[model samples]
Target chain A: MPYYRCVVPKDSVPYEQRAAVAKAFTDIHCGNTGAPRSFVHVVFDEADDRWATPYFLDGGNRAGRSEEVKAELLSDLMGAFREITGVAEEDFSGRITEGPAKWTMEGGMVLPEPGEETEEWYSHGQAAAGG
Target chain B: MSRVSFNCTMQEGQIGEELRAELAAALQQITQDVLGESPDDVPVTFSDIPSGYGFRGGEPSTTSLVRGSIVGGVTQEVREDFMRRICDSWMEISGCTVDELVVSARDV
Candidate 1:
C-alpha cells in the first residue's frame, strides 16, 4: 500500500492541480511497482502555511523493486510536484517510510502476504488495465 | 523502525509552540517506550489541517487523527493500549473528547 499525504498551504494549490498531482502520484507508483492505480490513496490537505511536504509510506509490496526503479519514482515525484506547484525542488522536502506488509489492510480486509494476491488486488489490477 | 505520523486538525494558535514541542516529545517517547525505537530515530510529524479539510464520518472535524506503523507481531491488546494512551494524551492536551481522537495502527 502506497498511501501518500500531500500537505500544502491553504488555497496554495489550485483545485484542479490537486487532482492532477494525485493522478501523477498514482501514475508514478503504478509505473514503478506494477500496483494498480485504483488502490492508490492520495489525500491533499491544506495547511495554514504555504509550505508543502509530501510523505509516503510504502508497504513491503514495493521491496521487490530495484533501487534504480525506486530512485526514478522519487525523481518523477519531485518533478511532478514542481510541475504542479511551480515550486523548486529544493523547496520541497519529504520522507518515505518503507516497511514490511506483515499486517496490512485494504477495503476493510487484511491483505495477504506479498505475492499472494487477494480479490481486491486482482480487481485493482483488472480495473487499472481497463477490464 | 516503527513510525508514527499524526494528521490533526487544529485552528491556528490552537497548538502553540510549547504545545507542539510537548506533542512531539510525547509521541517520540511513547514510540520509544512501546515500540522500542530509539527516541532520536522515531519521526513524528504533525500537520495542522485547515478547517475545511480533514473529515470524519463524511463531515469536516476538528479532531486529532493518528496513523501508526509498528513492527509486526505486536498483540492487539498492546496496540489497543498504545492507541488508548495516545488518544488520551491528545485529549488531555487539546481538550478534545475521546470520540474526536482517532488512532489506528498497523504492523509492518
Candidate 2:
C-alpha cells in the first residue's frame, strides 16, 4: 500500500476540492510506481500544535521509486496543492517516504514482495484483487 | 535514505523528554544500521493526535498509530527488526499496546 499522510494547515484546502486532492495524490503515486489506484491510500489531516513548524513534513510512503520518479511525484503533488488549496509552493512542503512492499496489507492480504508487483499487479483490475 | 514518521495519539506531556530523546536516538541508530543511512540524515517526525479525532474499526481510538517510510531493498529481516525495535520503544515510552501502536514502512 503506497499510503500517504498529508497534513495541511487547518482549512487550507476548500471542502469541495478534497476528493480531487486525494485523486491527484493517488494518480501521481500510481503513475510513478505502477501500483493500481485501488491500492493507494491518501489521508489528509489538519495540522495543529502537535506538528512541528512546517507541518508539511507530516510524511508519506514510497515503494521503490528512483530519484527521478520521486521528483516527478513531488512536483505533481505541489501542483495539486497549489490548485486545490490555492497555496504557494514556497509555503507548502512535504516528504515522500520509502517502504517495503511486503509490509503493505489491504483487505487483510499482504502485497507481493517488491519487484514481483509486475507479475502480480499488472493492471488496475488485477492489481485490485492482487491475484 | 529512510525516514520514519509517527502520527500518534497522546495528551500534552505524555512522552517525556528523556523518552523522546531516547526514541529518536534509537530510530537513528536503526536507520544507520539497517538502511546504511547516516544517523544525521534519518528524519523522524512525531505528530500528535487527539483522542476523539482518530478511530480504529469505527470506534474512537484509544491508542496511537505510526506509519512511515524506508529506503528500498533492505531485507525483510532487517526491516522487521527495525520495526520491532521502534515499536517496542514506542510502547514502552507511551504505554500504548502493541496492537494500538501500528507501525508500517514503505520503500523508495
Candidate 3:
C-alpha cells in the first residue's frame, strides 16, 4: 500500500501535469519496490497550506522496507514531481511514513509484509492490472 | 470512549446519499459485531475526493478508502475479519468491485 498525496498550491497544477505526475509516481514506486502497480495510489490535494514548501509529497507505505529503499523512493518521487511540473527543487519536499502490513487489507485479503508476498497476492495484483 | 472510528473517502458521484447512509449504518453494525463497540459510540464519516483529483495506477481512480482506527487493537485474526466484513458489505451495498476499495483497520 503506497498512497502518495501531492500537496500543492490551489490551481497550481493543471490536469495534464497532475496526470503525468501520477503516472510517473506509479512507475517510480513500482520500479523501486516490487509492489503491484495497482496498489499505488496518487492523489492531488490543494487544500493544505501548512507546509514550508509550495509542493509536498506525502506518502504512506507498508512497513518493513530498509531505510535506504525508503530514502531513495522519496527522492525519486520528488524528482519526478519536479521534472513533470517544472517546479524548482526548493519548492518541493517529501516524506514517506510506514505502517504495519497486517493493519490493512486489499482485495479482501490482509496485505502481506514486504518480502513475504505470496503468489496468491501477486495473482490478485495481476488480475487487477487486467493481465 | 468509543473503541473504533472510521473515515470513508470516496470519489465524487460514486455513491449517493442513500447509499452512504446504508454504508455508514453497515459499518457501525460491523463494528458492533466484530469489535463489540456500541453502534452509538462508533463514529463514521464520509468524504469525497472531487473528480480529477484522484488517480491510481496512472489512471483516474474509482477507488475508495475506508480507514478504521481502533483504540486498543485486536489480534490479526480479528483485524482480518473486520476488514473482510467491511469489504463484503461495502461491495454489496455500493456495487463496487473488490479492486475499487481499500480497507484498513489501523491500531492507534
Per-candidate chain B TM:
0.78, 0.74, 0.96
Clashes of each: 0, 9, 0
Best by DockQ: 3
User: Of 1 and 3, which scores higher on TM-score?
Assistant: 3
* TM-score list, all predictions: 0.51, 0.51, 0.97
Task: State the lDDT of candidate 1 residue by residue for A6-107, as single tens digits.
Answer: 666556677567667767777777777666554455556553434344322222233344677767777787678678878666567664555444333333
Write one digit per residue (lDDT tens) for candidate 1, span B5-108: 44443533446657877776776777777767777876666666544433322233344555676666788657666666676676677676544444556664
Q: B1-108 in candidate 3: lDDT tens per residue?
A: 667999998998998888988999999999999988889999899999889989988889899999999976478889889999999999999999999999999988
Give the runs in model 1 whose Cα sits over 4 Å from its true position. A48-64, A112-120, A124-131, B1-72, B75-104
Candidate with the greatest TM-score versus the true structure: 3
- Can you list each candidate's DockQ? 0.08, 0.09, 0.88
Give the TM-score of chain A in candidate 1: 0.73
**CAPRI class assigned to model 1:** incorrect
Q: Which residue pairs of candidate 2 clash?
A: A62-A97, A98-B70, A98-B106, A98-B107, A98-B108, A99-B105, A99-B106, A99-B107, A100-B107
Clashing pairs in 3: none
Which lDDT tens digits does candidate 2 get at residues B1-108? Answer: 335443333433446555666677777776677666787876666655533333222223344445557656777777676667667777776675544444565554
